[model samples]
Target: MKPESALVLEELRSKLRPASVAQVGGFRPGADPLTSWFLKGVCLPGEGLPVWKGQPMFPLIQIRTDELPVIPEQLKGIALLVLFHNREHHPFDQPHGEGWLIREYATLEGLELLPELETPYHPFPVRWVSVNDDAPGWEDAWDIIDLSEVNDDTQASDSFFDDFNRYGGTKVGGYPMEIQHSVGIKDFVFQVGSEEKVNWMWADNGIGYFHRSAEGIWQFSCQFY
Candidate 1:
């Protein structure tokens, strides 16, 4: 944890009800990986209110990739936006794919809350798309323009959570770098598997890959945008 995050966690303990914190993100089929990617921006107080016991809960919102509003001017040139989620039962391990798909869809739906910045500037647009290992042809892959070069370091710290917490209860600390903006789609691919085996894509830098492992685990991998 970063020094700043520790301070925030301490503060959360002071202000909100006590709750357990669990890691949420992609995991390998059978064994748990050392590090799990997380949803960075969304946070909640108490697990029940959101009806889900996961960290970095995704709020109900609608998103359409084909018709995204103008990138929020504020985040226009930012490098990355990390997102998080709470742990859940292994979907693939279960019998039918229905339960797993529903849960996974909910997580993706919750992602909408993270990009709710002043209109015309969102971190990146994401959606479910087919993916394979061969280098994606233009029509086959999604395009994520790089803005890391244009971002101003001073403004990077300007967080939406600061305002998000004002309406809902606040968490003590902010997002972790691993969950925030550090990891990207590439990292997720290496962690999970490549397109030949996986069935997802890297939208911008975030994880949005989908595939199943030979061991029978239904897997979906992604990082924050």
Candidate 2:
């Protein structure tokens, strides 16, 4: 939280939920997840590879939700979350396997990791970590408390939340790092940024956000610079 306009920021702050943050990186141990399998396909639902249009989808990140330090209510029964996207685009309105895929698991019971995919981004485990100072984007703020409600403090408050530099990072909790506009998409839980260590990068350095819906289903979107 920045000290620039702490006085008027409380309204925005109260609308946001704070949870334990986690970093999804560290390629050691050779068993970490989030490895890039761009061209290669993933075995989801135990049937066949997930495809979009005519191309196959690849796994972007794999999280053992049960491994997190603090599992939020939204992720209660989820044991694993494997995110997937087409080689080029991510059409949000499309169905499950059209442009992107979010594979959820209730348990790791019969799970298996494929052999060699020859992907550039190596497998880095998603682990719990401390969250840095951050707040939702201005649009997200406006939707929560409304700009009109803030009265004369509009400009200061907008600048505070819209500053992407202050809030951008790859972490599990807190607020999302918006590259463009804030998504009114509720239940802001985790954020993913291009990790350089394992050669992880989305678009020209995009940031992805995750939100748990009221139905326990996760909604996501990625924005790039």
Candidate 3:
């Protein structure tokens, strides 16, 4: 690789942010999810949670923001974020918050643990671990500065992006590793990949993406092979 390209690659690498990854240890009442994704937590009652087969819906994920590593500045005061998927809705094709839901809490006072609820699949317990591995895929270039330097040399370009594929799994911050391609969601947040060990599958081994819209609303979508 040319020295100019190598220097540009180093500069580009400096822009990469680390995302906390899910190591997913065996069951525990509550394990630290690298302080990024807390799957279990107490919260105010989900008073209007949609019903399914006579049972209220189970939240797919519960994230505590008190310890989040990377997040938008506006969410600095938020206490928790929760996600719910309605079995009645399409995994990725429905309107935001209609089929899927993302709720953020401002405080934790008077909260309680989520009660046992029915789920379509076995909800295996998992926890998060911070990982230094995070890099934007070519698809995520729009979220970063111009890629002109990356395109400066084929070899340098190839070397930098080559790391993204090795990180195809659940992560916080950074970019969502593409199952098909990025949906171009703005203000992206975290993602959860289908875990075979936990039987968490999105369609045929897809990944779930959680992000925020321009209006500051959180949304959910899934992509699969």
Candidate 4:
């Protein structure tokens, strides 16, 4: 009966313990918090709006496997496996059967296969994939990638709500951008468990909360303070 989004968060936190991680800033409540800032660099300049060049919108959680204080039990085995099969094998990319299959799926579908709620009018479709015998460890890989980004030092902009209050904002020396309620950092919540309690209580004070949406996608919402 737990909310699906909370489950996702807990799973990652547990697995990546002792790793210094933080959530990048930029997610404003109702905004698409998970939207990757990397997309800005991908787009050509002068074609669209210049990327938000402000401080990173998200936290920086860098992990050096060699430096971890307490590596996950399963990961140790994985490292050993890589050590034994250095030339032909890779983490999650065994040269043989299902490992290879899952690796291929991860490369081609992992991002799209997030366990999320369905949505309409989104830039991308929200679909959930179950992990069963056929796919044993795929979820773990995604969890690592996601949790590694959560950090205590990352900071978000207070201007998000201000921008929304005004209904728009102009990028520094750039074109004007319209901020909408549906996309602003309001009207959103990140709660956990069957009771659906907010992960970050006092929604107006903390950085934000994250929860699986009614449609199943992992969504982030900012507090109002």
Candidate 5:
């Protein structure tokens, strides 16, 4: 990892306390062993830190240690830009419209860190964009900017699809363009207004999704890889 990336990870570990553990490889419960181990090895439990949905939640963290030879030096700086966001549906308390959190971490530096890695492991690049009431229009929130627009074109073949596939999960066999992705972590709502308030939502990619529904309510959700 790059110096800045490592510093940020270390800082995040120190600042955010792990509420719940998640497993990465096998079928163990609680938290992923690798992720749990990484968190335990880095940051210890603390008080007063923000918890995921009033419970403990651990966001996936990817660190490129020297042991991983496949990681390219060019991709070291990419990890620093990892972003996470919350998804909420209308009517707040409906089961059919599940409200959860989704995180998307991209190496916006234009480097494919681990090419050989498979699903849930591929390292894609992403950037952070926020759409708010201040934005020119609400529709601008739906625009997910492609990183290739600013990076080199050499690594551009099927990158977005590969990214969406990796994060969203393998495409279901017969579905036209519908993809299914897992909700790795739940989101905590930080209200920004009163009974009628503006809540800003951000995604792991650093982009914010916002919309104005009927009755002046501002709704937001993050779209991830």
Candidate 6:
């Protein structure tokens, strides 16, 4: 969408292969020094280029030019800020002074990874969030509960119930709150309130609530007490 972002996306789209995905931390086209930097300076498996473990990444998946529904009509392209950090000390341990380069593009090809990573990770799914054009009325129907009211000791709730349907991006009625379901593209649950004590062990004390739009977008509502 922006002039600088337009240039960056065009450059990447030209160098990418069809149906591939690569990871990068940051991208700057006309920086005086380096053009781009990795997340925590972690590079690809063997390449010497600097990269990071949980850098804000864009998985460029190839598709027919006519099939991408989310590509904005005005912006040249759109880059979603997908953060992949599962490590215990992740979001906090990231390198300092690094921010995601959100951009807009006109087409689907204006994004990519280096040739090496693309060959193996290409043909992957391209999932990004765009505005829901056909959102339902339920968009305004949801609630947020405090975990303090739901005691882990007795696994009891004052008023909140374990209704996974409250959070949806599709048909509704399914929320995976355990690590076991983390293997897929499903929404995982976590305990709300007091981030210091939040852990998988407190499954019974879960209090976060979310809802999904029919257009496959998730909306979350959480209240920590």
Using lDDT as the measure, the top candidate is 3
Model 5: lowest-lDDT 10 consecutive positions: 189-198
Output candidate 6 Cα RMSD: 18.4
- Runs of candidate 2 with Cα error greater than 4 angstroms are 1-7, 13-16, 19-27, 30-48, 53-55, 88-95, 146-166, 216-218
Task: Report the poorest 10 consecutive residues by lDDT, candidate 1.
Answer: 167-176
Alpha carbon deviation, residue 138, candidate 6 (Å): 20
**Candidate 3 vs 6: which has more lDDT:** 3
Best to worst by TM-score, what's the order? Answer: 3, 2, 6, 5, 1, 4
Candidate 4 local lDDT, 133-223, one digit each (tens): 1110222234233422323212211211121122111001101112111222221211111111212222323232232234423333322
Regions more than 4 Å wrong, model 5: 1-41, 44-50, 59-62, 72-225
Tens-place lDDT per residue, model 3, 157-189, is: 888767443355666676677767665536667
Weakest lDDT window of 10 consecutive positions for candidate 2:
33-42
Stronger candidate by TM-score (4 vs 6): 6
Worst 10 residues of 6 by lDDT: 135-144
lDDT agreement with native, every candidate: 0.25, 0.59, 0.63, 0.21, 0.23, 0.25
Better of 1 and 4 by lDDT: 1
Runs of candidate 1 exceeding 4 Å displacement: 1-50, 54-56, 59-62, 65-84, 87-134, 137-206, 211-218, 222-225
Provide TM-scores for the models.
Answer: 0.18, 0.72, 0.78, 0.17, 0.20, 0.24
RMSD of candidates 1 onward, in order: 20.9, 4.7, 3.7, 22.0, 19.2, 18.4
User: In model 5, how many backbone clashes occur?
Assistant: 14
The 10-residue segment with the lowest total lDDT in model 3: 32-41
Ranking by lDDT: 3, 2, 1, 6, 5, 4
Write down the RMSD of candidate 3 (Cα, Å): 3.7
- Model 6 compared with the native: what TM-score? 0.24
The global Cα lDDT (0 to 1) of model 5 is 0.23
**Error at 16, model 3, angstroms:** 0.6
